[model samples]
Target: MKPRILLVDDEENILKQLRWALEPDYEILIAQDEYEAKRIFEIMGPAVVTIDLSLTPGNSQDLSGLRLLEYFLTQAPSTRIIVITGSSDEASSLQAVRLGAFDYYSKPIRLDELKVMIKRAFHIHQLHQRIQQSYPGSAEGFHGMIGKSKSMQEIFRFIERIAASDVSVLIAGENGTGKKLVAHAIHNLSQRKDNPFAAVNCGASPEHSLESELFGHERGAFFGAYAQKRGKLELAHTGTLFLDEISKLTPALQVKMLRFLKNRKIERVGGTQTIDLDVRIIAATNHDLLENNVFDKDLYYRLKLVPLPPLRERKEDIIPLAHYFVKKLCRGRRSPPIMLSPEAEGALLMHPWAGNIRELENLISRAVVLSSHSVLKPSDLGFALNSIPTDVNLKFAKKAIEADFIKKALSKNNGIVSRAAKDLGISRVNLYELMDRYNIQIQEFKISRSSERQQMKTGEVL
Candidate 1:
C-alpha cells in the first residue's frame, strides 16, 4: 500500500485537484472540515498531511485550521503537516510553521512544486519513524561508550580481549573522541571493576602540583602541605588510574611516570619512604605521541596503544549516536522522546563534528531542552539549511537522495527487501546493489518495526 497522506481543505475543487495530483503517489484521504480531518487523522495516522488555514467555507477569519494544526501535532507529533493558505495569508502560514507545521504552500497551488514538497515531507516522516523505531536501548556499545560503526565495533572487541590483562594501555585520539570513556570501559571490564577508578588531567594542573597530585605528598612537604595526602596513584591501588592528556606531561613528570610504571613504586615528596603500589595505568592523549616531540619514547613504548578516530571519520555512527542522546536526555522530561527531523539529521551528518561525540551530545541535549516542538528540526539543532555546503558535486547529491529514497521504501515495507523493491518499482537485485552501495542494513529496518510495535504495546514512544 502507498503511504497515507491526509488532505484537509474546505474547497471542493481544491480537494479534488490535490487528490487527483497526489493519488498516483500517495493513498489520499480527503477531509472537508476540521472535524472530519481530526477523525481521519486519528484513525489513519497519516505520515504527511495538508490543512488549509481557513477550514470554514465562508469565514475568512475562522482560524480553525490553525487549531486543527495544533491538535494534530499534539495528538501525533511525528506527522508532517503542511499548511495551505492564500498568498495574502503569508503571516498565518508562517505562524502555522511555528506551531509545528512541516511546510506551507500558498493558495494557487502549483501541483508540481507541491508534489515535490509533499515527497520531501514524507521522506522526513520516514526518517523520523526509522529513528524512533530503531533507537530504544542505549546506543552505548561497550561499557557505556556509544558507537556502532565498524571502527567502534573493532574497538569493542579489542577492549574485551585486552581488558583482563594488567598491561599499561595508552589511548590516543583527538580531544572529545572519548578516550577517557574507553579507559573506563577497560577498567570496568577488567577484574578491577569493583575497585576505585581514579582520574587526573596531566595538563590541567600546574607543573609543580602535578607530581604531588600523582605521587602524593607527606605532611610539611611544601609551603601549602598542611597535611599528608595520598595522590591518584596511591588512591587507585589495586585498581585503574586514568591519566588524561598524558602527552602534556613535562619531561620531569614523564620520568617519574616511567619509573612508576617500571617498578610500581613511588616516593612521597619530602619523605624517604618508598610506596609499593599495585595499580594499572591507562594514559590518554589527544596528540599523536609518535609525531610530536612532547612524549617520551620509552614511556610511550611501554603503554599499549589504542587509537580512536574522530567523529567525522566515522559518519555511519552519527545518526544512531544522535538518537541515543535524544532518548537519554529526554528521559527526565514529561513529554515523549524528542525526534530529529530529516533536515536535522542531515545537518548532523554534514557537520565536521570538530568536537566529536561531546559536540554532538551537547547539541542534542540543548535541542531536547530548547526545542518547542517534540519533533526537533534543523533550527532547533542550531543549524540552518544554508549551513550545508553548496559546492557538492551533482553525483554526491544524487547518491544522497537515492539512498534516502531507498531507505524510506525499505522502512515503508518493514524491511522486506522484495516488497520494498516492488514498492520502489525496482528489481530485488538492483535494490540490493543500492543497499550495499550505501551500506544500508536491512536487518536494522526489520528490527525497527518489531521494536516500535513493542514500545507501542507498552505505551512508550520511541
Candidate 2:
C-alpha cells in the first residue's frame, strides 16, 4: 500500500497542483476546510499531513489551520505535520516549527522543495517505526539513527547524559561510523533543538574557503567579497555548530577556531567587530587529534571526548543496519517487498566491512535499483561469497553517485537550474549547493546560442 498523506488547504488550485504532483508516490487525501480535515484525520489517519496556516481566506481572526495542527498533534504526536503559510508570515511559520510541527513551507509553494520536505517527513516517520520495532521495549535513542548493539546502547546513554550540558563535545569515529548523526542526536535532545543546527566539513571544503564559510566576512573582506555574509558559526547563534573532519583543519584556522571556543565571541574575516554568539560546538574527527601533533593542544583539552565504534567492531548491529537501509531505500516504491536471501545474508555477515555502515547502505541501494527479483542474493549485491572488495573509498563512491545524478538531471533540463532541481526532486538552492560542492558549473551544460538558433531553424524544439 502507498503511504498515505493528507493535504489541508482552502485554495482549490493549490490542492489540484499538489494532488497532480504527489498522487503517483502517495495516497493523497484533500481537505478544503478544518472540519473536513478533522473528519478525514479521524477516518484516514494519514501518516503525513500538509496544512495551510490560513485555512479561511480573508479571515485573519480564524486560526483554524494552527488549531487543526494542535488537534492533530494531540491525537497522534507521531504523525508528521507540515504547515503551509503565506510568504510574509514568518511568525506563524516559526510558531508552527516551535509547536512540534515536523517542518513548514511558505507560499507561493515551490513544488520541488515541498516534495523534498514531504519525502523527508515520511522517511523520518518510517525510520522511527523501524527503530521501535528493532529495539522492542528499548528507550528512544535518537530520531534518525539506528543502533541495537551493546556498545551503541552505551553510546546512546552517554549522549543522553551529556546532551543537557552546554560543554563542547568531540566525537571520534571512522568515516562511515555516523559521527555527524551522533552530533545531530545530541543537538536534538538538548535544549537547542528548535534552534539552527549548522554543519561544515573541514576535509571536503578548501582551506581558503573554509575560513570564510566558518566566520562571517565584511563586504570588503577579500577580492571576491561582493557583500557581507554571515558564516556557519554566526548563523548557528544560540544553536549548535557541527564541524566534521576537524583533524583536517589548517594550523591558522585551528588557532582561530580555538579562540572562538575559549571566548564565546568571533571576529569576522577582515572585520574589527567581535560578535558574541551562544553557539554550542560539536566537532567530529576520524583520527585522534590529540595524538596527531597537527591539532591545537588547547582546543583538544577544551572538548569532551566521545568515541563512536566502527561497524566492524560492532558486528552484531550490521544486519540490523542493513535491513534498516533496505526498508528505508525501498519504501514508497511501486514494487513488492524485497527481502535478503539466505546466501545474501551469509555473504553480508562474512564480508569484512572496512568502509563500515555507509558501504553497506551503498551496496543495498545498488541492489534495490538493479535487482529484478524480490529476493536479493549475493550476486545481486555484487558480492561473491569468497571474495568481497574491502578497499572501497565509500566517500568518493557516494559522491560519484550524487554527482552522476545531478549531471543527468542537468542534462535532461538543458542546464536550467530550477527545472533540473524539479527533475531531481530537490529545491534549486539545494541543487546549487550540491553543484558547488562538486565544483559543477551550469555553464558547462549550457547549449550555445548559435546551436539553439540552428535547432530552431531546423524546426526542432530549442
Candidate 3:
C-alpha cells in the first residue's frame, strides 16, 4: 500500500493542487477544516500530515491548526506532521515545529519542495516504526535493566533460570554496569522475594565496622553499640543479601563471610550464641576476581560468577537503552515524550561509554531535564563535539575497523578463540596473536558460557 498523507488547508483550491501533486506517490487524504482533519487522522492513522496554521477561514484569529497539531502529536507521536504557513507567518511556523511538527513549508506552495518534505517525513516515520519493533522490552525494561543486545538477552535468560536457586552468585562488572540491579533481579525473581533484601557496601564504611555490618553485634558490643543490632546477614534471613564491592572486604570480614557460607551460621560480634539463618548471598565487584589477588580465592570459588561486559562491547544496545532512559526519566514531567535526534543518536552510538549503563542513564536524564526542545540533539547531550573524529586517517581507520570486527566476532561466538577464529576464517593461533596485539582478553568473552553453565546447573533454564 502507498504511504498515507493527510493534507489540511482552508482553501479547497490549495488542497486540490496538493492532492494532484501527491496522489501518484501517496494515498492523499484531504481535510478542509479542523474537524475533518481530526476525523481522518483518527480513522486513517496517516504516516504524514500537512496542516495549514490559519485553519479558521478568513478570520485567521484562531490558532486551531496549531492546537490540532498538538493533539495529533499527543495522540500519535509516531505520525509526522508538516505545517503549511504563509511566508510572513514565520513565528507561527516556528511554533508549529516546536509543537512536534516534522517540518514547515512557506506557502506560495512549491509542490516539488512540499513533496520532498512529505517523502522525508514518511521515511522518518518508517525508521521510527522499525526501531520500535526491533527493540524488545525497550519501554517495559527487563529485570529493572534496559537493553536489547544479544548479551543482555542472554543475561536476562540466565537471571530467570538462577533466581530461584539458593546458591551464592557473584556478579562482576564495571562500577556503573548495574551489578546491584542484577542482584535485585535475582532476589526479586527468587522464592525469597517477599523477604527483606539487605544490601551492604563493603567499601563504603571503615574496616572496623565492616565485620559488624555483615554480622550482627550484641548490645554494648562496641562504643557505639547501645542496643543489639542486626547486620545485613541477619536482616536478610530468608531473603537475599547483596554485598556490593565485595573485593573491598577486609581479611577479617572475608574470613567471617567464608565461615558463614561454609557453616550456614553466624556469630554476633559480642555474643557466643551461634545463629542459624537461611540467606542467599549475592556479591558484586568491578574487579577481575581471578587476575586480582585482592579477593579471597576460596570465597571466589564458592560463588557462581556472572560477568557483565562493558557498554562499548555491546554497541548495538546503546540507542535503545538511551531511549529507554529518556522515557524513564521524563515520566511525570510536563513535557511530551522526549525524542533523540539523528545526530544525538549517532553521538550516543559512537561515544565509548566508559561508565556503561549508569553513565548513559545519567547523561540521558540530564539531557531530558535540561533540554527545552522536544527533540534531544547532540548539544543537549553535553558530549564534546570533537570527541568523535570527523576526519578519519586511513591507517587508523583500517585498524579501528579491524579491531571492531574482531571484537564483534569474539562477542558473537561467546569469546571462544577457536570458534571466533573459525568464524573469521583465521586460525586460532592467528586470532590469539591479533587479540594479543590489540590487547583484547579472551576471558571477557568466556563469561557468557560459564554463566550459562552455572544457570543450567542451578536449574535457571532447561
Estimate the TM-score for candidate 3. 0.59
- The best candidate by TM-score is 3
Estimate TM-scores for all models: 0.56, 0.57, 0.59
User: Between candidates 2 and 3, which one is better according to TM-score?
Assistant: 3
Residue lDDT tens for model 1, 1-462: 688899998789988988899888888889998787876665456788999888875677788999999999876677899998988988898899888899999868899999999999999998976675464333444555677766688777777777877789988888789997798779867888656577888989998799899989999999999999888888788888889988889989999999999998999888799999999999998887867576788998788777788987677778888988888677636468778876677777778889999999998888888877888877899986577665433355446657867886786577999999998899999999999999999886775556778535323211
The list of candidate 1 runs beyond 4 A from truth reads 1-140, 389-462
lDDT of 1 at 205: 92
Query: Which residue pairs in model 3 clash with each other?
Result: 161-460
In TM-score terms, candidate 2 sits at 0.57
Candidate 3, poorest ten consecutive residues by summed lDDT = 391-400
Q: What is candidate 3's local distance difference test score?
A: 0.81
Clashing pairs in 2: none
